[model samples]
Target: MSANKTAMGDIASSTETYPFEKDERYRSQQGLNGFAVKEPFLPNGLGLQVRKRKMVRKRKNVDESPFSVLCAWVVEHQIGLSLNLLLLLSLTHFFFSRARPYTSLFLGMSYYNPKSKKYTQGWEDMYFVATWIIIITGLRVAVMDYILKPIARYGGVNKPKAQVRFAEQGWLFCYYSLFSPLGMYIIYQTKYWFNLREIWTDFPTHTMNGLLKWYYLVQFAFWLQQIFVVNIEEKRKDYWQMFSHHIFTSALMFSSYGYYQTKVGVVILAIMDVVDLLLPLAKMLKYMNFRTACDITFGVFIAVWFVARHVIYMMVCWSMFSEIPHVMKQGCYNSTTGQMISEDGGTAVWWNVMQPFDRPGGTICYNNNIRIAFTALLMALQVLTLIWFGMILRVAYGVLSGKGAEDSRSDDEGEDEEYEEIEYYDDKIKSFDGTNEIVTRTIALPIEEDVNAEEMNLGLRRKSTSPTTASAPRRSTRRTGSARATALSIPGHSDKKDILGRIGCDKPS
Candidate 1:
């Protein structure tokens, strides 16, 4: 790369006349070509003296203190504050749930205890959820900070961002490894099988055991925490898309749990979470600057993502469509047994299908409409996952083609920017004549590009070209070159009249 420097320098220095002369003239008139001074080019009568307006922001009051500023900051970041509050609530719930086996209170609302052998509902269910959130938080923190970070560092990942990402991926991997199997086991035990219509015929009525309940709560809290964490972390190009995803997935899981669709919910959770484990690990590798390994893992991630999200989710949709009507025809409520009976054996029926508990005299009611709504929502979730999959494809292409070495899809930083400061020392020396001589010595000083300089360049680009393509110059690939060398090597540098003096290049004769 360095060998091409001389060729690039020749190209930059060879020409005096450049393209965009009209652009430069127009820019001068518009004050886009370095700061153009206002002058009377026409007759004095036609000259206009326009005054520059100074923007004055209101000053802070002297009475304001640091504590007040801190409070204001907290208030401004409402989402972050809300998440913290929720975490505190979860922790409180955990302590109470442990201390008292089955009872807890929040905001003066006593916990609701489900009838023995009945599904969890009301306050007891919500209480259990809070407790499980705390447990998941503890597990996630333990795995990410302590176990995964150290192991990744030992395996040659030294960058802090990479370590953090690896830890997160490790947690995901560990979580699904434990939970997905259990979810499968639950489906097997419930006899839901692969038939979609079976869900309607034998909809879950049994009270959730501690393990399945914990799983649902953990799934809910994990994504909820992600919503908060992602906002506070370095923002990516698709930040909002990911934010939407976390919200959707979290809401869907919680709603499914509330609706007593835990049997199907477990399957969805298992399928959706498996692919996520690999993506972060690939990104972590990319952050660690391991190109080959990252590409390999990314390839694998793509394959797994397709199978899990598209293939498996398609099967889920198919089953729902086929099974719903079959169960609807035969479904009937049994008041004595508190179960829904159908032609199919042990079908997990939804609560909506049975007669309302309050209306004891009403005939067995059927509300198959809720089933349609559920199917649509589930389909919507799969569609959202597909949208994210498109982004993943773009990233994978970038990695494989060497077009984007850093994951442009991610915004994590592993290394800090280097800062070099040169200090000048001044000392006085007394001569034989008793006259004091002052001497000052300063070593090599690092010059950094002005932050606003890029903005100004962007303005110039916008003025000279089609606005759609206008941007600051592309970042240089060579990271260790001198500023002067960089200036000489940039494409179209010779055509940029305003840049010559700024970069210490000689004016063409």
Candidate 2:
């Protein structure tokens, strides 16, 4: 036993001086003899020669079932598929006489009078609106993914989350930029342009021009698609609030259209769309890191939001409350013939307070309860806007305090926390052809100081006692000791000293 101990001591001492012996020691410790790769010495005197063992991983075969393949293909080509469907429908509607009536129901405005340049609302308009919803969704996806994503990447929005946001804002900027002006132009043509009382002047018989009908339907389609967008996309902090807003907005538009109150709806849409243009512009600037532009755009957005939402929109809401009783024709009326009939079955022109039950048998007539509910929905929208405005103000305050602008409602990117830091070691050396070479071996281990020593030790011990380690040839302990000592001496890792000592690695003084 004494002789064996002396021989081991001599072997450990010789390993410290000789590079070849050290390499042999490392190979034995790692249990890699036949698998060990020999390389020429590096020109750098650092004596590094990394030999990474190639790991052959068999890739998992994905589900190639017909359903899975079809699903995958659909996901990849959804925009193309939607466009193709739209084209097919358009072609069928144009060329085929048999399909014309059915397709016309969904493809064009119902009750359109070219001579009068007006359109009357019908159940067919619902199908038309549904078709427009699909069209908007497809166009939105195509524009964002194909056009804006590349632009965002080019503009230094590298992170995936930032790129997504940039593309979303870019798409919104394009949409609102186009529609905001279109809405204003439509409103400008109307007799009720900025005139709140005129919204209720004609009531259900209010004539809708082709432009206004298309615009209102398309706007409604956009908001309905937004409901899908908020749900399908990555959720933000204000997701529920946004969800509620979209729902309410869609409901308000749909109810107004159904009740033939689109004059007020159009005015509300015109007022709301103007500020939407600036918000997305500001967000796009922010994502691109144009701090000055973002701040300026955001400031403009705030001013417009206050005017459009708080002042003008509230005026429309108030008009619904105060003007409907006086301006609108009251009592149960024939919506088609525009004739009011009293309960005694006589044609009566009664200009009285419209109660919920006052509508005896009218096809379309607004009542007090319906007006209150409609007004309440508009109020609810305002409440939601106020909540968002508060968030915007908070962001504005942050900007004032020199923090620069940031969306308070945006989701925080914590993806970095999932990554582990890579640690490099230059101490691992190999000897080849009479020159010493350093070998770089990457081992993934948590570098956080809070990592438990016992867990780390367990991991190391498992690696040290692996099947490969067990089959390794005997080697000098001195080289292994030196490597461990180097690891222990790593800066700011004093806590690891005792763990290294306990694991047969000497602690450096």
TM-score of every model versus the real structure: 0.56, 0.65
Local distance difference test, candidate 1: 0.49
Clashing pairs in 1: 196-319, 197-323, 201-347, 202-347, 202-348, 202-349, 203-347, 203-348, 203-349
Q: Which portions of model 2 show Cα errors greater than 4 Å? A: 1-75, 343-362, 402-407, 411-509
Enumerate residue pairs that collide in model 2. Answer: 47-437, 47-438, 48-437, 48-438, 49-438, 49-439
RMSD of each: 16.2, 15.8
Candidate 1 wrong stretches, greater than 4 Å = 1-119, 204-206, 287-295, 329-366, 398-408, 413-509
For candidate 1, write residues 322-420 as lDDT tens digits: 765665553444433436654332333344433232333232323455566677778877777777677656544433343322232333322222232
lDDT of each: 0.49, 0.60
List, residue by residue over 374-402, the lDDT tens digit for candidate 2.
Answer: 88899999999898777666645543443
Give RMSD (Å) of candidate 2 vs. truth.
15.8
